[model samples]
Target chain A: MLARVFEASGLSSVQISLLREHTEKIRPPRALFCPFPFGLALGKPNDPEFQHRVLDHAFSLLERPSGPVLEDFPEEIVPADAPVTPAEERPPDPAFELTALRGYYDRFVAHHGRTAVGLTGVPSTRFRGLVRLLERYAAGEEIEAPTPDLSAAQYARFACDDIKAFFREARMEQYPAENGPQIDAWFWQQTAMGPMMRRVRDRMLASGDRQVEMLSYGIYREPDTPNPEWKYLTPTAVKTDGG
Target chain B: MPHLKHLPDMKRNEMLTFPAQVNHDTPWTPPARPLREARLALVTSAGLHRRGDPPFVSNHHEPDYSYRRLPADTPAAEILQSHASAGFDRSGIQRDLNTTYPVDRLRELLMRGAIGSLADSFYSFMGALRNVARLEQETAPAVAELLRQDGVEVVLLTPT
Candidate 1:
């Protein structure tokens, strides 16, 4: 919608859309349909080279001398097959234990207050339940068979998302209104929970835990060798398909 | 197969019912100059904001017709994504900011002279907005004004 506004205001604009059907229906000035999962419209996470290529393709649309052009990206990003160990087979990272996360949350709230921390809808009192679920999942424990209301996988996702939101909101409170880079630096480097999460992720990856692999989707890691099947969406292909 | 084919049952209905505004009359504005000389700015509906900026209130019952004005030079690490939509996967964006808002890639383009310079400020809004009336009447115009004031000749919009 904003793309139309920019175009109506006389600015050439293009949109990188995850949904080609929607893009086709809306028919923005120009659209690039990326065949990536949600939240990865630009490219794979942390893969700067792939990201650059995606951006180049998106910006190149500006040179197309027409309106309502929708093109699909031809590249296919195959999910890497990392080993997935059952929860019971892996040991949990003690550093990110429920108690530790709670402690970190307490300290963070104490320093920054509760201003931005409650957005996740997960109450402070329930942090223990959240942490326990995460710990169990990290350990590769079978969760669905035990929990009646929610599967272990569901609980893990909720817990991790809540934790991430808590840390982010708390970090926001500390700065109030600061520059982006400085706050980002503080979140990843200065905040205790941020580094702790990274450590837990690293540990999980090393153990080849399936839950971690599922949860870590889109977290970019440079492949040992670039996949050979990658292809850029080209005008010729779009023309042949009558797109 | 279309990625939307994989959407969960709940979201499938919402996608089908989503009242997307399709303006068939919107005029095409070509760049005034060559690609290497036109000024560029990024606009995204990915709910991105500077680290310290107030996040888009995803819990609101009504569409939050608000935006974040990120400086052109804001580092990717400094940006945060807070949209609470369930339609898309967010794991990649969580690890690397560029997956949705490619500010770094734009900077690289500027350095390599693939495009002209960037605007002083980029814009972001939550893509989950359901109130098209408010967005059309209030937010879009405001953002358009900002781009016009910034002298942005081209905009790259990435929607989540």
Candidate 2:
């Protein structure tokens, strides 16, 4: 679904995994790989061209008629050997970027207008973290931000714009808070949060590695909710359709 | 029939290693449809992204990869320009790849009566996802719902 996300969001993303003994099981006849470490699937530290090459290689593999192929970019010729640079090598933040965090707060206010800090209690630290990351990127520093986890209660009432503003403030050093109140409020209400929640739940369930039943009770014979005939299996079971 | 562009040495070498052996026992044959006459629908992963849609944009770190459909009349130049990598050899020459999967190109075909009508609509998604499980589950179902809703018949999946 990475494609789905990219199509939806206009942003590119990557996935990485470390395969040790299970490397054999990692066979996707249709997939291509880069010569980088398994966990570092994209490329070596801060190399966009090498990363693009890896991605291009992966895309080229799709036209291979049909088959399994091993892609090896051994150490000697690999781009990873290029000299590494420290994060500090990036230029200092722009002038306006200094107020990025404050602007994020203003956007949060404009989107969630007039609420007590605790009402839409998103941690201030996340807001700060987002600003810092945005400032770095705007200064032309290539880096990945830490994925912040916030309490649902804290963000429950925070409108979708508030969250997007948080990320916007993180990625662009400024939030487009001027885009009217209605648009900001409506975006959050329409966000497909259900999927994100499910992803988190799936991760939790897999880590527990056991089948856990969720039971329901009702007062008086409760009206039936349409449960399908099939019992749940892995997430793939729901996706099955004859091709 | 038609000829496609000649495969290069490097590409030919890669092609040779494909595990699926084709021989007389399981020779490739037409699936009982005339490809030229068929009312085709294409689905590609050729980086056709929309703006601000969370699901499509969530994976932005890798590249601006996604999918789109070209209509039958969509100029070949347009496809080549918009999605440079979706190009194929001259023989396979999808002069208008849009003609088949052209969700965008289908409007003219509908007007011209090239085929009965669109199955409903064509679809595009990024094909670079490494986790097939989630893709199969959540994303595929949504696309299926869209296709089913549009009343599509055959689906032509073209991954770039």
Q: Could you say which candidate leads in DockQ? A: 1
lDDT of 2 by residue, A81-129 (tens): 2122222322233223324445555554454332122212335444444
Clashes of each: 7, 42
lDDT of 1 by residue, B1-160 (tens): 1365654554454455444554555558988987689888988888878766755653223566788999988766466666633235444564456777787777888898988788999999887554556676788888888888998898889876
List ranges where model 2 is wrong by over 4 Å.
A1-243, B1-41, B47-49, B55-101
- Residue A49 C-alpha lDDT in model 1: 93
DockQ of all models, two decimals each: 0.22, 0.05
In model 1, what lDDT does residue B34 have?
A: 71
Question: What Cα-based lDDT does every candidate model obtain?
Answer: 0.61, 0.31
- lDDT string for model 1 (A1-243, tens) is 778777887888888887666666666788888876656777676688998877778777877877677888889543233233322421244233434445555665565332223323467667655555555655556555234644344344444555655554444444444323334344444444444445444444554544344334222122231111112223342221111
Candidate 1, residue B146: lDDT:
87
Clashes of 1: 7
Candidate 1 - CAPRI tier? Answer: incorrect
